[model samples]
Target chain A: MSFELFSNLVGAFFTLCIFSFLYKDNPFYQAAEQMLVGISLGYGLVYTYNRVFVPYVYQTIIIQHQFVLIIPAIMGMLYLLRFSRKLGWLSRYPIAFSMMGVGMGVPMGIHAAILVQMRQAMVPIESFNLFLIFIGTIAVLLYFFFSKAHKGVYGKFVNVGKWYMMIGFGASFGLTVMARISLLIGRIQFLVNDVIGILK
Target chain B: MKKTIPLLIVIVGGLIWVVWAFSPHYVLQEVFYNQFYLPWAYASASFAMLLGVLSLTMMHSNKIKMRAPKWQYSYFFFASFVITCLAGFIGGIQKGGLFMWMFENVQMPMSATMFSLLAFYMASAAYKAFRARSPEATVLLIAAIVVMLAQVPLGVKLSKHLPTISQWILDVPNLASKRGIMLGVGLGSVATSLKILLGIERSYLGGD
Candidate 1:
């Protein structure tokens, strides 16, 4: 057989091996899982080294003669120091710096997620649908307000918030189911079209 | 000294990022982050993956040393890892290469199979948990059914209005609550980031 055909058959076998888990866990599924973990890790390491480490550090520092990049180069080495029992504390420096980058980036996320969302919530309320949306948003936000006791007039609004949140969660769950089903359909398509050649 | 030094680094590094974000100066925005911070971050991230690989290797090695159950399977992991690394490094990732061939034949199918298995779990979950136990549950069940049915071709055949009602439900009530929760989470993240920057939360430093 041609290499392409052989590869497709192997892929089909592996797919069936994993699907065997639906019946119950077996050696076939276990072997497939282990091979996947090892191969994925290997792929990640080589990809990172080739794409990121080479271009950024090797080329920039050595060839370009940018000695300044050595600072982060040292920091990156220090990250590996975590493997050492005694010198593990040194890893915290790089971790802290990376966390700082992550922390500082949060403001941009807040701008997009919160500020923009709040802005979008400000509808003209010309229609009943718009008004209901406006009220639903406010009520839900109030539900998350932990300081106030849920009683009296405020409690009624909180109840409305609870209902809205439930409906929202239900919709999300439905979407999730659809997404999973789509994945199943994709696998079935592969099995039928590629493996069995039942479909063109 | 260890904890104190890391905290200082966090504060200084965080301040630079904040300054870079808020400041519109060409140097801060363009030169500082793009030139300096980004390369360092990328280098750090690349090296960080080594830590994960090392941890995995040590775990499996120790498992083999102890003669743990399924110790033979660890050999599969080690051999696969070595073979893949050799293929990738020697062959390169170009089209029709061994690396690409292995990835297509092995990794892709396995990942899809694993993800697809979630469909069975979700179906079982929906069967059990989707009952109309209360007023809220009833609303949730009805909304879920409407949304699910609207997605399939059979639903359109059942009723043209199913899709419209599902869209309305999503566009109005769902968006409102989703926005509300997201706003809260965004604000909370900003607050936590500030706490971390200020050195109030030192858990990242590992221990007391």
Candidate 2:
């Protein structure tokens, strides 16, 4: 068989292996999962080495004569020392570096998610939908606010908020299933058009 | 010295970004952060990925050595990893190479199939659990049905207005609830970050 056809056949096998899980878990599915994990990790390693390491580390410090780049390079290499027992403690420095980077994003998240979303919700009520949305936003916020007792008028808002949240979750579930169904259709198309040569 | 230095590093390293956010000084923004800190992060991330690969390989190797249950699958992992790495290094990752062929044939189909499998599981779960016994459940069930119908051509044929109503449900109440959740989460994270930066959150430091 030609290489292209052979590739298609192999693809069909893996697809079938995964589809087998729908019926029940079996060795074919397990093997396919393990192989995928290995292959993707391998591919990621090579891609990272070529894409990030080559230019950022190797080319920058070695060829471009940027000596200061060695600081982070050394810090990066500290991860390898994690395998050593005594030197393992040294890995915390790099961990702290990465964690600090995460910490940095807190303000960014506050600005983007909190401030921006709040501003977006505060638009003037030009339409009926806007009126509902404004009340929904306030009600949801009040529902989450646990400082005061959820009694009296606050309790009523909380109920409306709960309804809004339920509807929101249901919509999310529907969209997610639709997305997965589309992916299912894609795999089915490949099997028919590529493997069986029936739908081409 | 080890503990003190790293803790100090955490505080200083964290404060640097916070300073960058508020200050926008030329030195902090263009000089130090862009030129120095960014590359450090990239290099550190690459190493972390390598660390993950190494850890997984070691785990599988140990599993084979111990002859654990389903250990036979470990060999397949090794073979796949070795073969893919060889293909990538020897043939290069350019188009039409062994690496790309393996990825196209083996990886993409399997991954896509794995994700698509969720559709069946979700459908089954919905069938088993989506009983509308209460007023709240009735609202949820109705919303889901409306949205799902709007996703296909059948909905348009069924009612012409189904799609518009679905869109409004998503745009209004759905968005409002999501915004509330995001605001709550953002506030919590900001508090935690401040605690960490100010040295109040010593749980991360661990061991005295």
- In terms of TM-score, which candidate is strongest? 1
lDDT of each: 0.87, 0.86
Clashes by residue pair, model 1 = none
Candidate 1 deviant stretches above 4 angstroms:
A198-200
Error of 2 at A156 (Å): 2.2
Candidate 1, TM-score vs. the true structure? 0.96
Which pairs of residues have clashing backbones in candidate 2? none
| Chain A TM-scores of all predicted models | 0.92, 0.93
Q: Which residue runs does candidate 2 get wrong by more than 4 Å?
A: A198-200, B202-208
How do the residues B42-64 of candidate 2 rate in per-residue lDDT, one tens digit apiece? 76667887778878988999999
lDDT of 2 by residue, A21-120 (tens): 8888899998999999999998998899889988888898899988887888888888777776778778777878877865567779789878998898
Interface DockQ per candidate: 0.74, 0.75
Q: Model 1: what is its DockQ?
A: 0.74
Q: Which 10 consecutive residues of model 1 chain A have the lowest summed lDDT?
A: A101-110
